[model samples]
Target: MDIKPLLLASGMIAATALAGCSTVGGSVYTASYASITDAGYKLPAIPVSKVPEQYRRQIVSYETKEKPGTVIVDTTSKFLYFVMPEGKAMRYGIGVGKEGFEWSGTARVAMKREWPVWTPPAPMIRRRPELAVYRGGMQPGLQNPLGARALYLYKGGRDTGYRLHGTPEWWSIGKAMSSGCIRLLNQDIMDLYDRVEVGAKVIVK
Candidate 1:
């Protein structure tokens, strides 16, 4: 079977739904996410020991219908819930679209990448040509724009150009930022990525 058509459909659905809707303060600080070469970029040193051991442990919330293999990003609460079976969800802090980019809808995980590359869209480059430097792709690591992982969103089966990925700017959590992508802490994203498989259902609300 031809998967291209199916993939495209899913991408479109994901894009349409996952696109952000709520903006925090109607202020977009572009400089906060200015471009930086991967070589020069680094994740702020964090004391893993200091990171609450409980938070590191998967959280099972009875209120959520999430299963062990699914992903849900609740922008309202600034939480990303990875559903574990028996009405449990592993929740993580998230940074959503600031304002104009905020969106709430349902989607699916069409694909995923580890240490994915960064390719700012043409418009993004147009708005800030400095992004033109990393057109094709970048290496995955502390410097990579996609952080530690990227869970590509889809609707019926098409590319929405939206993603749930990690960011070096851990402080950005709970804020509306990014061109339109859902950003999460590197460690948190890595953990979620490991638990989700391709084609997993994603609900963004």
Candidate 2:
């Protein structure tokens, strides 16, 4: 056997594995660039090409009894789905709460806001004094933790202190890193914000 042939085979195998690591599915590639907007405040427009293929917004075959317009969050899989008729859904990747902060329940979107303000809760401020500066509420802008939009969650007519909101940290789209809120990429959340209504149902599991 020629040693050169064996060396070429090994190189080919290594190259195949490296390429697979960068892809979410067969023939689908992640996005490479994004656009930014400066309408009053700087806002980012995430390119569909920059987002991973699986995370990009798409209509998918989903089985659920929930009516169209309902939002379902599957924390384990890091996906959020907006149910539609005919067994379909608009699915987007999400960033969920960290280990001990995870929650599951039914709630309703009680309010919606664009470029929402963020106020560090008392407990959170106590845990990290640096957050105390935002106790009165941080102004809405690119650096705001709430990003470009927010849908406030409520249960039994009371605020749950949980939210479905956008994040400036686009890289966190498929991770478990939020305090307790359900987070989406800024562009995705902006799209979701337009479709979801104040009285729409939300299921988190």
Candidate 3:
């Protein structure tokens, strides 16, 4: 059986998604990421070929002392690992904060939300006055910075003002971007949102 047609179709899907010239449906990487509607918001397919394979979500033999249900963010490597039982982890590529904006600490998933509203922090607005227009909170939608899901972080019962959230900029994964949030692709974050519970331990390193 000739497989050239299958390979060519996969290539076209990636190209169309990358060029943003067409709606992308299933081809390759469909099991991991395909365009979908979540909470009435349509998320475009991610051209996962443009992202390194290691950054794609996969279950790996990750040895860690952290108990299951803990989230470990490896800042240097741009990876987020959700600890599972039996010395394994569900690892996903992530985008972290830039230079001075990097944060490292233990926190809890204080809250979880679907299609979360985004309000620029006061300090952020101070830096970019144009965002003052959103001081009242930006309504949730596809264009929202928080994307399809957000896991708010807190420590010692106080809001840490950081979040593990989804981002529309899937290309930014495996890189240092964002102000301080840990951002993942829409599909990855949606998977995480369902797996992670509020009060899950999060260690950012």
Of the candidates shown, which would achieve the greatest TM-score relative to the real structure?
3
Candidate 3, residue 197: how far the Cα is off, in Å: 1.0
Native RMSD of candidate 3 (Å): 6.6
TM-score, predicted candidate 3 vs. hidden true structure: 0.85
- lDDT (10s digit) by residue, model 1, range 111-148: 88877888888887898988888888666678676897
- Candidate 3 clashes between residue pairs 3 or more apart in a chain or in different chains: none
Q: List per-prediction Cα lDDT, in the order shown.
A: 0.70, 0.83, 0.88
Sort order, lDDT high to low: 3, 2, 1
Task: Please give the RMSD to the true structure for each candidate, in Å.
Answer: 16.8, 9.3, 6.6
Cα error, residue 62 of model 1, in Å, equals 3.1
Give the true-structure RMSD of model 1.
Answer: 16.8
lDDT of 3 by residue, 72-132 (tens): 9999999999999987778889999998899999999989999999999999999999999
